[model samples]
Target: MFSRRTVLTGMAAGLFAPYFHDVYAQSSALPARLVLVLECNGVYPRALLSTGTRAALGGRANTSDRLFWDAYKDTPLVREGDNLASAISLGPLAESAGKIDLVNRSAVLLGLSNLIAGGGHSSGTGGLSCAVNGAGATVDAVIAPRLRRGAPFDVLRLGTSSARVSIVYETCALGPRKPAGIIVNPSLAFDSTFGSLLGGSTNGRDRKMLFDFALADSRKALAEFKGNSNERLKLERYVSSLESLRTREDQLTGMADRVRPYLPVAPKDNPLLTGAGSPPDSLKWFEAQFQIATAALLGGLTNTVVLATGTSGFDVAYGPDVSDVARHNLQHGLDAGQNWEKVAEVTRRHVQLVANLARTLAATPEVGASGSMLDHTAIIFMSDNGEQHHSTSREWPKLVVGGNALGLKTDGRTVVYPKYDAPRNRQVSNLFNTLGHAFGDADFNTFGQEGSTRIAPGPLSELYG
Candidate 1:
């Protein structure tokens, strides 16, 4: 019988050998670790910021509502509780946020507005992915190629539902368009992607054999072009694509060597939903996807990823008490007293997901890098709109964490952009462009429609060191 290692080696060499040439020659100096966390219905600005006077809470000054007037003061020790006595008063999300290196390193993009023209929530969601005025490319697409020049999984666009899946569009050479690489139920994809990583199971061993066979074929094909530059490039990429796979295998090996062996529980027997149906066990599915994404990032499997927890038009039931209110419905009453409570709860759940992801990254140490895996990673967390009713983008909660290890800043207090005058609104594209530049896109100055009055030139200078 062929040894397991031999089989896996043979499969990777064979299957991945063909595509290595082109990918290796064209690579960029972007972050090898990146993640994008997007939420639906936006966040309530009032809750995220303090306004009234109550006395400075925590370590930082300006913890009262009066701090809202400054827009530049930072909350030192905002925590979650009934009384807003902490530095970064995050309300329900206090627990998770506290676990990470909490900093008001975020900045408000005042005067920024979404170019939502048609199609209610669905259309707006599409616009968020691409196009601030008309159909255009999104920030995720712009940075994906730069980060994963030699990797197989350049960008993993994942979502909880069908609508969420379409949030990241790809602008290819053909034209400005959307790419078809969405993993709607990423947990199932995770199982299939790293099947061999869960060794010991009969099914896993069989999958490993198949992968080995493919790798052997790829290796054979690569040998045919030994000295050719193009072929050598292809070989290099094939190796890079296997990074995540190799990491999984190493993890399994270590697990096997442990005194007490442990294995992931097999999935339940219920059929998960595909498109338009119930919520489809989002909590469980998302947690699994998070694990897979974290593994991929830690193993250098892929450099860029966009994970949409849910879509903008989602109306699934979160729980019995939460009601089956559509995301759009929650935003319409954001200004109302009672509506803020419901919105706060939904937003808190979303925040919890992000916090969980951050903590996971922080826990894992990098191979050749100092600090935890999260230290070298930059996570961009934001929503399509600030509220559901209007497309206004002012006071939008845009948080950037962990890039500080990558030379970005987030330790100081929150900084608000200069207010715009009159009816002219800043376009969300400006914010998008700023993100692109942050990831090392030198010529990435402008995005979206020309003269659309949506995208401004403000670079969000305060966000950087």
Candidate 2:
């Protein structure tokens, strides 16, 4: 009666029974919502720090703009450990602007590896597994099956930009050679997900009849309750709830107009609605996608969402003065200045969007709890590529925010593993495994294929409080 999974899980438990006896447990029935922002074209981890930390750590920062340096910059690291959570900076406006402390609650992971993905090549599931081209399910899909139980959608994989090259655009894999489909059209995504409530499901009369019938049925049931007085009171409350449902439905009928503005703008003079339907690689399109994702999460349509944008060689603009340039070219040793500025700019923008989402969730109270929903949610910001353009798969930096509800240690502590040459260096698969363990899935001792890199089984013990 034992399947391969059961056997593997049992074997793993026996191996780690001594060290992880109490570390492993069942996944919480109320797990945190997952939002994955998959960045392409690598990241400049050194540029994110200050000159003092960068000098000690030997990083890159070739900027002459004092105003820029004064603004969107922070060391976040020291000789010993990271600065306390409050000292962390959010963006260029952090010094002058006052906002929420969402950024301070973030964690940065250094000294991580994939050992499988080649430079300038998207790993697909290879990032999570040794199987190339997503021979197995990636980390997001692995968590989706359990986190999104009974949700309207299994996992909402969305992105900006269509394929301009024959790279691994699809990150989620169903199995070997099977990449999950991603919806690149923003307007279509909105229509497919919320169209029913937007008057695209049934005609007005049919909808009215359904609501009317439900109300009448509930009222009749309330009148004929022949049980105890307490039972009669419950029936009356049920009848009242039916009437409330009708009011909510009527409110939804008129909400489409208000919702349209937040969606992608339609093409000019194009009846096919080509522009709006397609999620182009523009800032507006990305924001619109964020709006749709926020709505889906808030509406309880999906529990896990993955959003990806651009690629390594892709061209993008950071500032008004800075023209569009290819990220691959800028990600070099001598060209570190341009790369530092652009990466910082892009990261600030994306993190601002994350801040917006966190703010929205923070204001909204949890469904059946006392604190806000943000207390039970987590967001991961990581690059599909590693720490440099045309990376050697040596380092994959990551940022995780707001996983306290899932038992994660997110006290703004920046954890940097030893260098690859050092003894006991770790890879990202262990981080993914650590995540799986946090989510109560100890069966996945290690994700991906058995590549040449040496990796130990089990999660990073320091990541938990």
Candidate 3:
């Protein structure tokens, strides 16, 4: 008889493996994979929208989720027609952002609103799930379960080691009122997934074998079911899942080996005890989270990931590069007498991290598949509130990267839905449903705030390929 811990050890190692690996099989036909990146205190709409957007819209003022221009392919993600990739402020990845944007599979969702969010810090689950206190599962949770047979962990919530963020930063809600737990520290997260075992074992190889054997038992169980012809049909998915798990274990093992050098080493003492200083290790813990996220996606450990980049709990004085003040202050434009450029710098830093994530996935060669890992991923980065430090729920423009996967059409276009006052105005719900469509869920036709007369129920067909 296997102990509960032992069973769990096997389940964790293999549950998601089947679903993630099969759905994420390297193909343009695609399966379901989503990475949702949410930030607080909205970014400016002007900065997010390109100069070409107006002309593409034909200078039309009122339209909602309406198709404006169809590139059918990606172009430079720079503002206006100019291809100044270097000026995009992706930090170390600035060089690739310009060139990649041209061929990158992506899109932009403009004019999204969360009237239900009630503005302010309520942006928490409000912005993510489009319902207060996560009254509905966020898009990530809703779609994650659709991947193949569902990943071991349906949704993996991750938060940066930065200081505390407002309620606006709640990254994921598994179901109605079910906010997902976040693993704040990357080192702890790594151990939880790959370190700690049931028998207080710390050796990575031993743990891997133990889990692998447990998975072998699961496969045997499926085989027992298969022996009876009557049960074979019902157990087909079971057999596929177990087989996928066995195959995915190798992927996970390879990923672990590849990411070992980039892992963050923990400290002997809690550095929060200090009165003044950085985290005491300048190895970039934020970067570590992205590295883990990449491996998780690449290895099929999870199909959905929600990352809240910087919180107020970890105070980072970015120094002369951004500011000597806390991120919260910079977010609110309170530090240094509200230096807007400083705020932009902080926002850019977040973008840079996101850019790095895209680049990392792009670099990884997908096993038994074509293109890179990114070709089979869809990453959405958006703000909890509208375009301002404080929001009015008017305009929420999100940057999208990764395409060809998830059945996302308009992969290379900027779509501005009708404004708030327009007759055919679309709400944030439509965009969320659009994601649902990408996940291949016929049931997720419409999600969020159903009873209201103003609510529109449907996916953005214009964006759904």
Winner by TM-score: 2
User: Which stretches of candidate 3 lie above 4 Å from their native place?
Assistant: 1-29, 54-99, 102-104, 148-151, 161-169, 197-283, 311-317, 331-338, 365-370, 453-455
What are the per-residue Cα lDDT tens digits for candidate 2 across 73-106? 2322222344422212244213235455654455
TM-score of each: 0.64, 0.68, 0.67
Worst 10 residues of 1 by lDDT: 12-21
lDDT of 3 by residue, 85-123 (tens): 222222333355343453235566666666776665436
- The global Cα lDDT (0 to 1) of model 3 is 0.54
lDDT of 2: 0.55
For candidate 2, give the lDDT of residue 356.
Answer: 67
lDDT of 1 by residue, 1-465 (tens): 222232222111100111111222234453446677665445444444433212333222243221132332232222222222132324422335346433432222222445442323433333344343225545555566666744545565565543444233221111144333445455455454445454446766675566577667767777676577986996866755554454444444344332112223433432233322455545444545555565455445566666665553354345435435654555565555555576566655655666666666666665455666566677776655443435344434555556655555545334333333224334455555655656666556665554545534644454543
| After superposition, candidate 1 runs with Cα above 4 Å error | 1-32, 51-98, 104-111, 116-134, 162-175, 195-263, 269-278, 281-284, 324-337, 390-395, 419-427, 450-458
Task: Report lDDT (CA) for all predictions.
Answer: 0.47, 0.55, 0.54
